[model samples]
Target: MIDQEDVAALLGTEGPFARELPNFAPRAAQQSMARAVQHAITERETLIAEAGTGTGKTFAYLVPALLSGERVIVSTGTKALQDQLYFRDLPRVRSVLDARLKMALLKGRSNYLCLYRLDQTVREGATFDRTQASQLATIRTWSARTRRGDRAELAEVPEESPLWPRVTSTPENCLGVECPFYDDCHVIKARREAQEADLVVVNHHLLFADLALKQEGFGEILPGASAFILDEAHQIPELAGQFFSQSISARQLTDLAQDSLSECNGVTGAIGLVLEPVEAMQDAVRRLRLAMDALPERGPFHQLEAKREIGDALHDLREVLAALTDVLASQAERSRGFANAHERAALISERLDRIAERDSERDVRWYELFPRGFALHATPLDLAAPLRAMREQTQAAWIYTSATLSVSSSFDHFARQLGLEDPQTLQVESPFDYAKQALCYLPSGLPDPSARDYTDRVIEAVLPVLHASHGRAFLLFTSHRALRRAAELLQERVPWPLFVQGSAPRHRLLEEFRHSGHGVLLGAASFWEGVDVAGEALSVVVIDKLPFASPDDPVLQARLEALEQSGINPFMGWQVPSAVIALKQGAGRLIRDVHDRGVLVLCDPRLTTKGYGRLFLNSLPAMPRTKELANVQAFFDDEVSAPA
Candidate 1:
């Protein structure tokens, strides 16, 4: 077992060996995290840690984790963090520690190219378009010399390019180890490395996929590891819910039909001409779209009652696809190529049938209508059962840490939802002087979130802070509607350049915001947590309201019904705590570093009106609070005047 004192000393060292390493400054929270990880590994106990921002928790766990001399698997909430550890931090630590440790980064199969698909596409000469044809030529040329065949190397190719599916393999389509190119497969090689490595880095989706036995090539990720570290662990519950539940979409059916037709030469064959069925499916989809489009805008589809016709059309389409599957299955013995096509068609048919069957559920089912296209999705009523099963099966030490996991010093809310029983929990406050560094302003006289003038009041209250800070702010909202309203109001009043979420990709928008110097970014949901912008660039964060899911939402309603049936109070048990965790995520974005300073402006009056408001406020970092706008301006003025 590793000694905590020795681990702390190693992390604090600033010698020649540690110069290039990301500085691991020891804060109170970092030391606490180190001790927790050490105790868990030695005692074989489960731990839930809530380390605030600026704690340097990554290095805290990494140090003791490396010293344990045990196989460790670190799972992060996002792909960006997974890449950061595998590419940047791991190498730096390995060099200084000089511990001959083997490490590998294992991503889902979608990240690698499939040689068989590439070969088939090359032989058949199915060019997507002129642009895609050129890109495919480049990929084919590069595939010969490539060792890993990782798709990330094709940087010039756009993500939405058609050639992607042609070159990559999905779980339903892959031939697995039986393929002739099995020895040369990049995915297999990566998995082989993971099985033997001392440490492995993966994301939450891949981790949960492994737990549920849904991963494509390899079975599980953590069977070899003695301990599992989950960073940004807040996302695990929702991801686990998704992996545990079953879902199928109309797009899958369309893709299957298209792929089946692509493999055939003409209108007749041993598999019969799939062209007629494909055309019929396409026609049904077009009719379904027209029926939905005919409905009034902005109302629930279920309210129309006319939606049953659309469902009937879907039923007819499923029957046609099923017939295609039967025809394809009967010819599987004739040719290997036909057999593969038939299997894909059959899976697609079954999935669509399931979707059609689920249309009657009380949960919110809606079609996402975009400029040129749309898709349908359905979420399960509750995710607790599957998540609980996953936790019970783990024999290794399980560590769940995030900057925002608890609300008001109680883990009961999130813990109960996750089915965690009596796990060790900790909530480490930020070491910064929040009273002197920031202000939490709740403007009076603002209309309720439901009122038409709410957006106007929010902008008027926040505009002064932005001007005082000289355009360094983050205007966060719970919905896109409010974001758009605020953006419009701000553009009419403020002179600084503004950045909206979808105007550019998230990474580019952040880069532009950081570099612009005069920046105000407006975003929803995703900007709440896992965002680190220290220093003067982000001096203020304005939240529109305490984020609460729409009461009419199908998933939330279903979960409520499930709870009610079991004789539980859904509000105290579900809604309130869920909102508290989400509010914590939004509020935690303020102070990223000890040197960083900012103001958090919450325009929602519910924090003062509702009895549950105190729970939300107490859950935030113990920042100084106020209702006066002048005090906020005065605080920023003082911060600006203070010596750097």
Candidate 2:
């Protein structure tokens, strides 16, 4: 085994960042984190670590992971972070360490190009607007010359444009090995590289997806990996909830019907029997869509029973799907493409039946309406058992690291959520001097967060802090409703350039904020974590309220119900702790580096008035705090005579 100190020296002041880059400072915290990671891998045990921001955590784990002789899988929370690890950070690590490790990046299948889908779309072109037509023309040019065929490489096309998904393929739409362009498949090539590399970088969604697939008795995608490291591990419980559940949407059924209509338009014999039922299925879908449109908003699946038209439509759709399945079974001599499509159809039909029948006991059924269409879903109430099974299935050293994984100085909440018991745990504090460099202002005398005027009061309260900071702040809200209200209020109040989240793409908004260097960014959930903005540009993070999951959300309700059945206090056991972790994540946005200075302004009155408020405050890093607006101004001004 490599000595931790010897390897730790490589990341010290005189090491990689110092020798290769001009402005690099090595701290003892980063070295300590790297040592912990190294020991976890070497000893073959599970470890949970909370390394605060500016610990250079990316290198803390990557340096040990690359140096360890065993193959490692580094999973991240977001694709942007994955790209950063693979493109930017890894090269810098290689510059100093002599580790000749081969690295590969594998994204979810949707990110790669499917030649068959592109060809099919072109050969059977549909009506397109001017923008869609231009976007396809650009994709066509790129397809002819690009090697990787990754969707992210198309910088010209807007991420939200509908043209991209039309050209790409989903698992249901993919023709698999029967594709004519199987020889040049980008997904297959990426997977092959992943199989051969010493280190593989993947996002958490794909990581759990592969785990879920492996449990179904498939061969492992990561066969020889001995160390499995997760960055932003706080997101695992929610993602794992999504992974462990089963779902089938109305759009999925509609897409199948449309595809069969295209395929069976000119065919004859028993195979063509699919066309009639497929058409009926399309009408049933139309009925379902119309019935849902009559409703005021989305509700649980049971609520659909009140609308007799929806149940009638489901019955019609189910009957047609059964007929379609029977016809496909009769055609035993069908081509490989037909066989694959039949398997997909049969599975989808069965799920639609289960969700429609509402035959869920341990699971929960819910529905939501989107602009495109509506989707009915059945998700498991508990994922802990499945996650524990995954740990047992893989004999690897598992290390979970994030800046905010613990609540009130305990990892019990995090561990229990994932069925992880008594794992080795470490909490490495941020090297930033929060005592001298930052201030946490929790104002008093605000209405209850549930009050109708809570958002209005919050705006009135944070205006002073924003004024003091000179518009270099992020007004992070818990919901879109609050975000809009705050953005509307702040736009008129502040003079500095204001950049709201939806005004541009996330990357563009951050860049514009940096360029303005004195702009206020109002963002919701996505900005709570995985965002890195250092220096004096972002000097404050104003959280409008405590970060807690909405009680009305289907997934959270299901989990809470399950806890109640097990005789546990869901509020104290789940809600408060979960809120604590989320609050820590939001607060972490401030004081990103040692040189950075900022104040965290939490306007929620509950932090001081409510009993559970102590838990949230205890989770934050220790900093000088105050309730007075004068002290807030002084913190920014560096005044010695400021009130304590």
Candidate 3:
């Protein structure tokens, strides 16, 4: 293993950044990270680590990954991190290491332009408006000089533009080797680079998709990697479930119908020939919509008795898809121009077939009708089998690291979920003085999270903390409905500026909150993790509940039912540990740095009322705990007065 002193000396000599660089020298935690990577490379054993926020973990892993002289794939939880690694961190490290290592950043195919589709669109000359025509011309000009063909370069293209599908290929729409522009396909080009690169940066979804062979072109990732490093590994279990599942949306069918109509009219002058299938799909969508419309607006899906009607519509839709597939397949080889269109139709039909196949026990299938349209989802109750298969096939040192992997300092919960047995694990606590830096306040008398006054009580409990912290706070909720309600109530009651999740994109909301420096940001799910706001811009984290998955949630219900049939205690087996991990993630948003100070106010009162509550407390940082609201106010007041 490389000596820390020696590595530090080499880093200093590398001169990637000037002496006056703003970042601090790599700290002790970073050194530990380096040693761990070196050990993993030398001894091919799976390792789990918990590196805290201030650890400078990116460089800690990257330095050794670059130095090891072996192929490596680093997977992150979010696209933001992917961009940071590919655009910023990798270049700096490569410059400093002076190693001629080939590095490639591969995102999901959606991020790349589909050359074949773009060519077809250009030829058809379809335009929504004069402005859209101008945009298409601009895109055509940009495509000529784009070496990587990444769509991210076209900053002006709105994601919702109808032209996107015409310019980009889905897995179903891709022609693979048969594509006329296969050699120039941006996704293919990116994969070719990944295949040859020493280091590959990818997001968890892409990595899982590759591992599951769900991706169109690639069969797997990490074929040559000596090690696979997963950052934000806590998200893997859920992401694995998603990747291993199948989903077909009504909007997708409708879009296919619309696209087919447009292509037939624009390209082949055969709109009449395509009208039957298009109208069939439209009629199926209308019947499903009408069935859903008869049901109550909001309730558990199981409560609605319209399942039989919805099932009939689904069956009818499947037949329509089959007919469309036959029509397209019959004409696919007839013309070069319609080949992509035909392939798309075939793909949609196959997906519909997958949805149509009825499985009694292995998968949980459901339909959800949102405001826009309905979607059919089929999810495996357990992803353990596929995840284990990937683990075995890779045959490399795997390290899954994150701030919130353990519950009550035990890896048993997460390990069992991922189907890893007796894996070597380490729980490195954050080295900050949490007792002095933060407080965990649990208000006493709030109703259970399901009650009508739950959101109101939570808002009331957090108002004092927000005022004490002077609006630099995060109001994190587990449910979107609860979050919106809290945000509304708080907006009316609190004097500070308020930022809600749906008002803007998450990154934009964070930017606004940080810039305002006098607002309380309310968000759910994503905001609880992968968010980093240091200093006084964020001081208080108010959690509305214990962050438990609802018992009625279809996925959770399915998993729990499975556990019950297997003679396992569903609450202990699944709910308690998961909520503990989630609560820790919510609490973690506070005190991100050694100098950072803040308070975590959990208003659920379950922490005091339930026996499992103690487990949640044990999983949290060893911060000073108080049940009194006045103490929290005083701590915030003192910290504000004495600081800086």
Best candidate, lDDT: 2
Give the range where candidate 3 is weakest over 10 consecutive residues by summed lDDT: 12-21
Arrange candidates by TM-score, descending. 2, 3, 1
Worst 10 residues of 2 by lDDT: 263-272
lDDT of 2 by residue, 5-30 (tens): 96688778767667876666787888
RMSD of every candidate to native, in Å, equals 3.4, 2.8, 3.3
| lDDT of model 3 at position 363 | 81
Q: After aligning candidate 1 to the native by TM-score, how far in Å is the CA of 200 from where it should be?
A: 1.2
Candidate 1 at residue 196, lDDT? 89
lDDT tens readout by residue for model 1, 195-214 = 88889998888888787883
Best by TM-score: 2
As for TM-score, the candidate ahead, 2 or 3, is 2
Instruction: For candidate 2, give the lDDT of residue 432.
Output: 78
Clashing pairs in model 2, backbone N/Cα/C closer than 3 A: none
How would you encode candidate 3's per-residue C-alpha lDDT over 303-415 as one tens digit per residue? 33347886676678778877876766665665543566676677667766775675547787766668767766678888777678778877787888888888888888898
